[model samples]
Target: MNTLQRRNAIKDELQNQKLISAKKLALKYGVSRQTIVGDIALLRAQGQPIISTVSGYKYQEAGTAYHGVVVCQHTIEQTREELEAIISLGGEVVDVLIDHSVYGQIVGTLGLANQADINDFMSRVKNVNHNLLASLTNGIHLHNISCSDEKVFNSIQQRLDDLHFLYHD
Candidate 1:
């Protein structure tokens, strides 16, 4: 297939699938992984709501009602507990961000909405040589979380506070 055709197929795949990996897409399309990455970048430039996560790419839909940013601090060992607290309280962990002394701001899309997503993310972190972005800044980071309403968002904050995951001055 042509480049345009392959990109179109990739966009369709994003809409149809929950998560897609660049490696898997390259294998399916008979292209290099770098090519798939470029295609995704082009698609994003053209206004696709594609988000890259640890698991894979996700096509974000506008069904969410409320979004809020939370500051959190915890050890690497407490990552799973923090995530569970947020997810169990009906918050979708949209992404994590940290300000680096050199790189400025770094962000990682999470899109973790359920226990399964959390499990996959945790497993990927444990099994791969990948390090959490928060690790760069001494376990302090920001999370953009989404929920159905402000009530749920507040509840998430409270739960995080209860768990001592919320950062405070």
Candidate 2:
């Protein structure tokens, strides 16, 4: 396929598959992974609602979902539990934000919406041996959560509070 065709195909694939990696897209289109990355960049530049997550790229449509940011502080060992608590209460961990000493604010797109996504993220955390963004700030960070309503977000907040994960003065 031509460049325009391949990029269009990539957009369609993202919409259909929900989440896919550049490697997978490259394999599917018989192109280099870099080429797929370029395609994704071009697509994003064109205002496509595509988001790259820890797992892969997924199309994110504008929605009426309630979004809230919660301050949290916990150990690395509590990462899974924190995420689980949020996901179990119908909260999507949209992203993690941390204030770095050098960099002002760093945001990591998580896109963790379920148990499976949490599992994959935990696995990657172990396998990648990379420090989570929170580690930089002594386990203090902010999570932008998306939920169906304020009620669900409240439940998630309560759960995190119960788990001693919510940071408060």
Candidate 3:
């Protein structure tokens, strides 16, 4: 099969399965890792909504349900406040995503659910000489948020809206 065929097949597999790794696709398509990367780029350029997480590539299709992405902007000091609001609303702040001119979407999984978790995460970031995802973009970042119910989700949204931290643009 050709590169285009291989890329299409990979996309189909991802849409059916939850995740797929580059190595698996490379082997299946009898191509190199670089070729797989190029194919992924091609697929993305064609407007395929794929998320490259630490586990693997995930395909987002229409009608397929997902939690949500909430874009918010705030000063670095407000990080804790934002996290607190989400946690208080019973939502999980899954990961932080920032757009990088070079690396595309830079995502870091915080997996934080409460104030103590946030404190530990902040400490780690400070000690590792790394900045929060929002800090990389001057206090603008997208949070992948999830909750058990619409009520919780709405509550979090309301809290964020009240705080003037939610950015819809």
Candidate 4:
């Protein structure tokens, strides 16, 4: 198949599967990993809601859940507690966003849907050079979290507030 066909196929695979690695895509399509990377770039340029996570590339799904952005301030040490609080309360931590003087709005996808995801994130933060966006903004950041219902959202808000992590403006 050609580049167009391969790209279309990649789009389909992403839509159908929760996550697929570039390596797996390359093997399936008989192309180099770089080819798959270019295909993903073109697909994203065409407006596909594809997000690359530590696990793999997947399509982000929007459902009936209520989504809200909560402002928070905390040290890097509190990252695990903050993430656990949200996930334990039935909220999916979608992303962390911060306003940078130079870059304007910057976002880092947590995609922390479960305990394992959060653990992996914290692990990478410790082992890699990935800087937390909050570091650039003096420990103030925002989390885009999704909840199944209003009650869950309220619980998350209350917990974060109690932890003194919620930024009040």
lDDT of each: 0.94, 0.92, 0.78, 0.88
Stretches > 4 Å off in candidate 4: none
In model 2, the Cα lDDT at residue 83 comes to: 96
Any residue pairs clashing in model 2, and if so which?
Answer: none
Q: For candidate 3, what is the lDDT? A: 0.78
Q: Which ranking of candidates, highest lDDT first?
A: 1, 2, 4, 3
Residue 141 shift from truth in candidate 2, angstroms: 0.6
Predicted candidate 2 versus true structure: per-residue lDDT over 61-116, tens digit per residue: 56747999999999999999999999889888999999999999999999999899
Candidate 4 C-alpha error for residue 127, in Å: 1.4
**Model 3: pairs clashing at backbone N, Cα or C within 3 Å:** none
lDDT of 3 by residue, 1-169 (tens): 8777888898889889966778888888888988988888889999998866534577753442336678899998788789889988788787889998778999886556567777776676567777676777878889888777677787888899899999867
Q: Name the 10 consecutive residues with the lowest summed lDDT in model 3.
A: 59-68
Estimated TM-score for each candidate = 0.94, 0.96, 0.58, 0.88
lDDT of 1 at 154: 97
Which should have the higher TM-score, number 1 or number 3?
1
lDDT of 1: 0.94
- Superposed model 2: Cα runs more than 4 Å off: none
